[model samples]
Target chain A: MSSTPVFITGLGAVSAAGTGCAATLESFRNGNGNPCTAAREETPIAKPVFTVGDPAAIANAEEMRTLRLATLAVDEALSDARFRKRPSDIRVGVCLGTTVACQLNDIDFYRELRASGQASAVVFDRYLRGNLSAAVAERYGFCGPTLTITNACSSGTDAIGMALAWLRAGLCEAAIAGGADELSRIPMAGFNALGIMSATACAPFDRDRQGLNLGEGAGILLLETDAGVARRDAPAVLTCEGYGTFGDAHHLTAPREDGSGLEAAIRGALTTAGCAPDDIGFINAHGTATATNDAIEGTVLARVFGTDCVLSATKGYTGHTLGAAGGLEAVFTALGLREGWIPASAGYKNRDTSIPVAPVTRMTNVTGRYALSTSLAFGGNNSALVLGRQP
Target chain B: MKTVLGVHGIGMISVCGRGIESHADAYNHTQSADSSSPIRVCRVADEILKDRVTLKKMRRADRFSKMSALAARDAIDLAGLRVSDGGIRLGIVVATAFGPHRATFEFLDEILDFGDAGVSPTLFSHSVHNAAAAYIAIMLGSRGPACTVTDFQYPFHAGLMTAAVWLHEQRCSHVLVGYTEESSTPMDRILAQRHRGQPSHEPVLFNFSPYASKMFSEGSVFLVVTRPDQGGVALDLDRFKTGNDRISGLGSLWAAFKDGGLHLPQH
Candidate 1:
C-alpha cells in the first residue's frame, strides 16, 4: 500500500434520518429520528423499520429502489465534490456493500417455486440487476474494477477499506465506496426467526434495549487521488487513513464472547493509521442493541477507550441498516470531523450495567483529527476504519 | 510496496468430481453440445469425503463450508505448508455469489415449518454469507485477518486483489484466497426460469455467457499465495491489470460482459 494519503473528497447519505448529508446531521444534532410506524408491504414480522425518503425526481423506479438509492447518494456525493460541471476522464471505481439486493431470495418468486416449482425469467433478471456493484458502475459509466462485498453488516466498512486499498494500489483514479440494502421480507423473516428484531424503534445501548430495528438506506463517499483531485479541482473533505478487518471464526451468527476479533481489528486499524487509542476523538460503534452484540461491542469499547471515551451509536436514529450501517456511520464520522461535533447515540437513555459503556446523548464537540468506526457482523467479521481530518 | 506472490498451491472442486484433475477434465471435454439442462457445479457427495481424513470435523458442517475447507486443505497440501505449525501467518479471503444458499434455504424452511418462535438457531448460524469464510479460517487455525466478499461480477478478481493487498501490507504472510459456490434448488430453478423456453447447450466454463447462457456453476478454487522469492509461478495483479494477463483461477471473466468474445491475454 502506498504511504500517500487517500482523500474522501465528497460524501452522500440517504437513510431514515432523511436524504442528503445535512438532513442526517441536523437530525443527529436535534435528536429527531423517524422509525417507520407500520410494517412494510407483505412483511412477515411486525417490527418497525427505518426507510429512506422518496427517490429524486430524475431517478426513475425502473432503476429499482436499491439501485436508485445508490445513484441518488452517488449523485449527491459528486455534486458535493463539485464534479458535476467538470467532466474529465478520471477512471472511476465502484465498490458497494449490500445484502438482500445482491442475493437471490425473491420471496414471491420463491413462493411460486415452492408451490409449483416454476417462475418467470423476467423477475429473476430484475432481481439480478437489483443489487450489484457492476450495475452501479455501469449506471455511472465507470470502467474501473467493481466489487460487491456481502460480509453481512460489516460489508460497508469493508467496502470503504477495500476502496482505500484500491487507491493505495493505484487501481483507479477515484472510487465510489459505500453500502446499500432495501427492506425486504426475506431478511425480516430470517431475523425474526432468529429472534433479534425489536417490535418497536430500537433503543441502542439502553439497559432495557430489546433488539435492532431493521432499516433501509445507502451511504456513499467519493474518494479521489491527488492527481484526480488536481485535475478536477475538487476539495478533499477528509482522509481515509486505514481499514482493518478480522473474523472471529468462532461462530456463524454470534460474536465471540471476548470480542477478540474486533479488538484485533481495532488494533490493526490503529497500527495501519499509526494513531494511538487516545488520538481517536470519538467512536461510531456498531451498537446493534442485540444482547450479544451490545455486550461484546460494549465490553470491547470500554476496555479500549476507557470510561471517558465518548461513544455514539446511531442505530437509534436510523435503525440497524445492516450493510449500509457502516457506510452511514462512516459518513457521520466524516461529517463530525469536518463540522467538529459528534452526534449523540440516539435512543440511548440509560447504559447497560453489564456491558458498562455509555454513549453521547447529545451532539458534543470534540477536538481531534482522527475518528474510529467499527462494525461487528454476522460472519463474525469485525472491520474498523480510521478516518482522519484533512490537514 | 508492490510484492509478487508465488502460486504455491491450487485446489478446485466442482460437480464433475474432486481434485484438480476432475475439474480440468470436465472443461477439456470435446463433445458436442446437446443437453437440455442448466449447468450445475459439481458437488461433494458423502462418498467423496468418506475416505478423506482431514474432514472428520465436517460431518455436521454445511456443504458450502465443507467445500471451502476441503479445497483449502488440498491447496495447503500442494503448497507444502504445514498449517498445524501455526507459525506461518495466513489470511483467508473467500468470495461467492450465492453464499451458502443451501443452508439459507434450509433456515427459511425451518422458519416456515416451525413458527418464528420455534425456529432453530443452528440453522440460522450456518446460513450467513460469511459462514464458509469463518469455517475456512477456523479449520486452518489461521489467526490472521479473514474476510468474505460476495459478488457475481468477478469474485475471483476481487478476492485476488484482496489477497494481494494483504500480502503487500504485511498483515498476513500468506493469504488463502478462493471462490466457492454451491448449487441450490431455488437458485437452479431461478436460473432455469432465466434460461427457459430455450434448449440447454452443453456446459462450457470460461466461455462467453451472453445473458442467455451465463455459466452459473458451483465449485471452489483456492490458492496459497506467498512472496515471489519463495519460488513457483508468481502472481502479479498489476500485470494482469495493465495487460498480457493470464491470471490463474480467474479464467476469461472479461468474456461474460464483452460482446466481442474473450481472447486469452498474450503470455
Candidate 2:
C-alpha cells in the first residue's frame, strides 16, 4: 500500500451487464450475463461478444464510440463523486488505458486509401483528436499530467497505478483513471486469427473452456488524495492500497510457463500493501478462459494464495474486455470490498485438475478489508491491485 | 530529501543515424535545404536497422519493435551495465505518439486480401502497441516493471515523469525510459494533405513559434536513468519542456541533450 492515502471516492462502469454501477451490481447479484453473437455486418465469424446496449444513445454525433463509452463513464463517475462540475481548487489529471483507441485501424479508411490512393480526412482527424486521456482532459478542462497507457490488457490497471504514482509524487491531487475500449471488428478479427475466440460464451477456468469472448465497456474511478477527499467531503469507502506490475520478458503473446513474472507482481503488491497472503479476502482473477492463461494464472494464484483461497473470475459476466478488463475488475473488486459480498464466477462448471484452484460457483460473503484484482496482457505484462475498505 | 535522477547513458536512432555520437554530429552539421519532396518526412533508413545480433532475437518483430530493441540494447551497452550481472531491477517505459501503424495496416491488408480467418496470428500479435516494449524486455531478459504510454503531445515527457516516479518509489534500480514512433504511408499521406500549401524544410530546433516549418520524423531514443547518487550527467526534470512546434518526437530531445540546452545539476 502507498504511504500517501489514495481514496477511490467514486466508481463508474458501463458494460453489457448494464450502464451504471447499480445495474451491474444487480446483474451480479442475480448471477446473470448478457452475451450475444456478433452481427454478420460486424464480422463474418460468429463469435459471442458482450457489447454495450445502444452506444448511439450515449454518444454524440461525431465522436468515436470508444470516446462515447469513456464519456458516459466519466459523467457517471463525476456524479458519483458528488461534483456537479469540474472542481476548480484541485489539480486533476486524466490517465486512461485503452487498446483499440490507440490504434489507427479504421478498415474502411484504410481500404479507401489503399484503393484510390486518397481517403477522406475525417477518420484521420478523429483519430488525431481522440487521444483517450487528451480528449477526456480537454473535455473537462483538467490541467495536470495526462497520459494514455496502452499496455494491452493490463493498461487499465497500469493506468490506475500510474495515477497513484502521480499523487504520491505530488503532481496531482486528484485523477480520473481507468480504461475504455469499444468492441470493434479489428480486434475481433485479430483475436479470431489468433484462435482465441470461443464460438460460445467464455467459461473462465472451466475444465472444458474453449477461449475468451470479447466485450466492450468503460470503467472509471475518481481517485483523490486525502486532502482532496476532505475538501470535497466525499465518502471514502474504498482505497487503492497497492499496485504491482511485472513483465514476463518471455514471449510476445504468452505468459511465462514458470509464471515467475506473475508471482513477482503478486508478491510485490503484497509487499507494498504490507500484508500477508492470508490477509487477502479474495482474488478477482484475470482468467480469460484460454487454456494457457488459465493454467498459468491459476497456478500462480494457487501458489501465492493457497489452493483454498476464495477467488472468482468475472470475465464470464463481462467477456474479456481487453484493456477495460483491469478497470472493470478493479471497480468490481472495490465493490466487493464495500458490499461485503462477491458474485459467483459465472460460466464455470467443473474445475480443471491441471490447475490447483477453482472459482466460486455461487454468491459468497466476505469480511476482509482487502481484495486483489489481477490482469495479464499480451506482451507478458502482469498487474495486480490491492483494494481496501475503510475500517 | 528530494529525489534526483541522472542520465547515465543515452541511445537513439533517427533519420540522421544511430547512437548519441551520430546525433551530435547531425546537430553540429547543418543540412543543405532539400525542397525535393513536398511531403517532408525524415524516416530511419533500413541500413540503420541491420544489427544481426539484435535481429536474431527479433526475426519476426516489425520495424517498430526493431527500432525500439536496437536503441534499448545500445543504451544498456553504453551504460556498461549488464542486467543479468547484479539483481538490478530494470524497468522500461516506452512512449509513442502513434504505435506500429504499419503493422496495423498490414494486418488490415490481411483482412482485405485473405479474409479475417486467414489473417496471420503473428501479424495480429505484433500490431499491438506494447509489442515494442515486450521485444525490448525479451531482448534484454528484463523482468522488471514495463509500461507503454501513448499521447499526441508530450509522450516522452510523460515517460520521464513515470520513470522518475519509479525511481523515487524505489520500484526499480534503473529505468530504461524512451519513446518510439514509425512513419507509415497512410500517415504520410495524411501529413501531405494537411501541410500541402506550406513550404517544407528541415526542422529548425528551439523555434517555439506556432507556424514553424516542421517535418514528420520517426525513430527511437532510450535513456538509462538512475538515482543522482549513481552519477553520470545530471538531468533537471523540472525544466524539461515540450511543445507542438518542436522538431520531432525523440529527435528534439536528443538535440536538446546534445546541445547542452538541458543544464547539469549543481550538485
Candidate 3:
C-alpha cells in the first residue's frame, strides 16, 4: 500500500480557559464555565462571551494581537507532544485558518490613514497579510511550508487536512496545523447583520436554540511523518486517518436543506478512512446554534451514524470560534480518545422534535478507537475529518 | 516509483509580462527596472491580456482572481482544450496568501459604516475567500473538485502538490493549478502609513512551463497536467519535483525531468 500513517504528536489550545493547553483541557474536564458577562454592552447579554481575558493585558504588544492565541496553542501542542528541541532539520510547516486577520488592527490604522493620509508604520505592520503565518514560522524557527487557510469556519479544518496531505505526500517532515481568530468587530457586526446572533445563551441541538455567540480562540496540532517520529520519545496521541471536503455550490450563505453536500462530505471522509458507518464511535458535530445548520447536521448525522452513535456539539461551551472551530473541536476529539471519556454537549437541553438525531446530553465513559470531527461554513462548504486512535 | 506526470501548458499574469513568449523574453533580457527605490517590479500590463470577456462582469473582482482566470484560460488554450466545443474532465487548484482582499476590505468598510444596514448583496456574495476558485469553476464549467488554498509561503508549490495528488489518485484526467495575489488599497494605505519611506508599485503576472525559457515574476500560472498514456500536451513536468536522490520511489520523475526546464525563481 502507498498509504503513509501520520500521527498527532502535539496538541494546544488557547480558548476561554486562558492560554495553556493543559489548563484548557483541565477546565473542560472539570466542567468549568469559561463564559463571562461583558461590561461594555448596555443590554444584559444573555449569552456569555469567552473573550481571551483582557485585551489590554496582552494588547500592549501589537504582535500579540496578531499571534497571542496562536502562540499559546503552538507552545502547548509542542509541549504536550514532548518534542523538546525545535526540529528544524526536517521541513517544519504551518497551516492556519482565519477570516479575521487583524482586521480590527487594520480598521484602527485605516481610520488614521484614511483621514490624515499620513501612514503609521506601526498601524499597517500587523495587517501585512502574511504576517501571522510568517510570524509563527519565524518565532519557532521552523523553515518549511507555512500557509493560512481562510474559508470562514472551515478554515481550521481545511488547514489540518492540507497538513495531513502534505505529511502523507512527504512534502514536509512535520506540520503545526490549526487556526486562530481573535474576536473582532468585523465578524461581530457581520453576524449581527445576518441576524444570526442570539441575544440569549446559545444552545446547540435544542428546540429553543436561537443562534451562536461569537467567540475567539485558537487550537493547533503537531503532525509528523513516520521518519520524524523515529526521533520522538512520546507516543502518538492519535492518527489522522482521512479527510474529505466538498463545497455547497447551492448557496452562498446557506446549507442545502437536503443535506446533500454535507452527506457527500461525510460519506467521502468515511470512505477515505476505509471505515464503516458503525466504526465512528464519537461525532463532534458542526452544531452551530443556528437553526438551519443544527437541523441539517442532525438529519445528516441520522443518515450517516444513525441515532445510536454517541454525539455532542461542543459549541455550547466554546461558542462559535469561527475559523478555529475545527481545530479546537479536533483537539477535543483527540483528547476524548486519550482520556476515554466523552465530553457532554455542555448546553443541549430539549431535543428538537423536527430532527431525529439526539446528542449525548451528559458525560459518558466511552472508550472508542475512532472519532469523526465535522464543520460547515458560510459558503456551504462541508468538511469531515476522521481521527483514528493511536494503535 | 511513481510515474512522471509531464506538464504540457502553463500560463500566468502578474507584475511580470504575460504569455509564454513575453514571459520568456522578459526574463531572457534580465535588467532590473529602477522603480524609484528598492521596490521590485510586479504586474501584468493591460495590453497583453486575451479573452477580455471573462473579466468584464466582475467589477469588484480583485486582481488576484482576475490574474488567475486569465492565466488559466491561457493555459487551457495552450493545451488546446476548448470548453465551447467539449471540455475535458478538468480540475482547478489555486493557492494564495489571501483571497479577494480588495473586496473583503470594501465589504468591511461598508458593513462597519452602514451598521448592519442593507449592504450590497452582490459585494457580500463575491467577498468570500473562495470566490477566486468558484469564479474559475463557473467560467470553465468545470464540475470537478475545485479548491482554493491560502497559505503565506510556497502557495504555488502547495497548489501544485494538491494537483499532483489528485492526478495520482486518478480522480481527474487533468488539473490546472494557479497562484494569484493583488495589491489592495487597504494594503497600500497600511504600507504607506507603516513605512513612509517606501514606494508602491503595480502588480503583474508571469507564466511557467516545462518548455518556456526562464524569467522571474509572480502573478498567475496554470499548468495542464495529464497521465502518461494520454500522450497529450508534449511538455515535460517531471523536472519540478523537490525530492532528493535518497528516495527510491518517483525515480521516473527524477530521471525524465533531470534539468530539462527552467526552474521557478524563489520568491
Give the number of the best model, judged by TM-score: 2
Q: lDDT of each model, Cα atoms only?
A: 0.74, 0.83, 0.66
Local accuracy of candidate 3 as per-residue lDDT tens digits, A1-391: 2368788888888776556656665666665445666522232223465677645534644664537777778888888877754674778888777767723335555566556755566544455533456678888888866667667788788788878877776668888988887766555555766777777767888899888887888889899887788876556768887777765655556777888778877887787778888888888898988999999999999998887778868777777888888888888878777777766676678989998887777777766678899998865678888888875
RMSD of each: 4.9, 3.1, 6.5
In lDDT terms, which candidate is top? Answer: 2
Best by DockQ: 2
Tens digit of per-residue lDDT, candidate 1, span A293-388: 988888898888887888888888888888888888899889889999887777788867887778888879977889999998886789999999
Pairwise TM-score winner, candidates 1 and 3: 1
lDDT of 3 at A231: 73
True contacts kept of 2: 0.79
Q: What docking tier does model 2 reach? A: medium
User: What does candidate 2's lDDT look like per residue over A1-391, in tens digits?
Assistant: 2489899988999888889899989989988666887742467878999988765556664777788888888888888989646667889999899999999888888999888878677888788788899999999988888989999999999999888888877889999999999888888888998898898888999999999999988899989999999988998999988889998999999899999999999988888877889989999999999999999999999999999999978988889888888888898998899899999988898989999999999999987888999999999999999989999
For each of the candidates, what fraction of the native contacts does it recover? 0.47, 0.79, 0.18
Which window of ten consecutive residues has the lowest lDDT sum in model 3 chain B? B243-252
Q: Number of clashes in model 1?
A: 3
Error of 1 at A323 (Å): 0.9
> Against the true structure, what is model 2's DockQ?
0.66
Report the TM-score for the A-chain of model 3. 0.93
Task: Please say which candidate is ahead in DockQ: 2 or 3.
Answer: 2
